[model samples]
Target: MKLKPTIFVFAIWATGLCHAYASTSHEIECPTEISAAALAINAPEGWSAYAQEGLRLRSAEPALGPPEEKAFLKPGSTKSIKGGSIDSWLELSGSGPTGKWIVCRYGERGEITLSKKLHDNTSACTVSSRREQVQVSCTW
Candidate 1:
């Protein structure tokens, strides 16, 4: 997806073109915390799993198969979402049925830490930067 550098000009243009323009790099919120914990626990035991896809779908990163077999977009999300990258670490976050998610990648170690809210109904985890099913704010 080709990202539009200017965020104010548009919110949700083409589904694939828009990623995360605003995500919390500071202290996280409740939704973010829960998701992070669940993702850590859900990690498969005795297997070294890393986020192969930075801007695409991390869940389907390991699937090196045909398009029909691969799920590039997470459930409840129409398109793949991505946050900006800092150095080698790519930060990603979104809120929907997935609640809030975060993925941090380390360059040298090839480490990718994934997190997502397992169950959330009380808090929306959104801000003023959202428009219904369109763009939801990922910032704190």
Candidate 2:
């Protein structure tokens, strides 16, 4: 019984240590530029523009969490993400016509792009355009 308590304490300590390591200054070589556009440009038929109040792009990799920079997309406008760095995933969230939704996409590191498509049960986010830097356009 005493041994069990000791083991449990060790486990907690180990978990904390892992979290600490994840937040340390670990350099991850990745693209430093990003851009996000919120519009109905390439949205599917019947789909319309909706405000993405909580649009954000951030690192999905645990080790890159702290160094994980984020870019926010305006609620109902199109603009470039000036200073943000992300690795692994891009998150898009907000209330749409149907309801509230949050979407995640695995990023393409080599190509410096997000996965081709983003969708929920009733709506989808498509890549409207891509240019000099990593540009993303979504409609829902």
Candidate 3:
């Protein structure tokens, strides 16, 4: 998929492209605890794992070929394979189910540590953003 950069124009003063605002950084967080099963059931069809956290769907059978690349639009997402580098995407390992799943490492300095898998029974989640921070709040 082609990525498009979002540019914000503030003012123009007859000096070419005057002022443009672009967000350089982003933060991904799910304030309310959630579970893999709950995520699989609750998340929308095209939900981003980066935005939802641990919401991966896998088939009972193994994948036929190599893993695919999953892009996370938000910040703090890591690169594929040896996922230490911070990026907006990840290379998912194995074959996911009908839905999309991004499996990559991102635990490094400045990255938020994911909480242990637990049960929450959350049926819906609301995502909000302010500046660079992305918040995901869930409810039953």
How close is each model in CA RMSD to the real structure?
A: 17.8, 15.4, 17.8
Name the TM-score of candidate 2. 0.20
Regions more than 4 Å wrong, model 2 = 1-3, 23-130, 135-140
- Over 33-135, each residue of candidate 3 has an lDDT whose tens digit, in order, gives 3344444345578875534453221111111222232232243243333312323322222232333221222222213223322112222222343333334
In order of lDDT, best first, we have 2, 1, 3
**Best-fitting candidate, measured by TM-score?**
3
lDDT tens digits by residue: candidate 1, 1-140: 77767763555464436444322323322221123223433457887655433332222111112233332332232332343211111222333433433332222342433333322222222221121111223323
Give the Cα error of residue 116 in candidate 3, in Å. 4.1
* Candidate 3 all-Cα RMSD: 17.8
lDDT of 3: 0.29
Q: Name the regions of candidate 1 deviating beyond 4 angstroms.
A: 1-26, 29-94, 107-111, 116-140
For all predicted structures, in order, the TM-scores are 0.20, 0.20, 0.21
Candidates 2 and 3 compared: the better one by TM-score is: 3
TM-score of candidate 3 relative to the true fold: 0.21
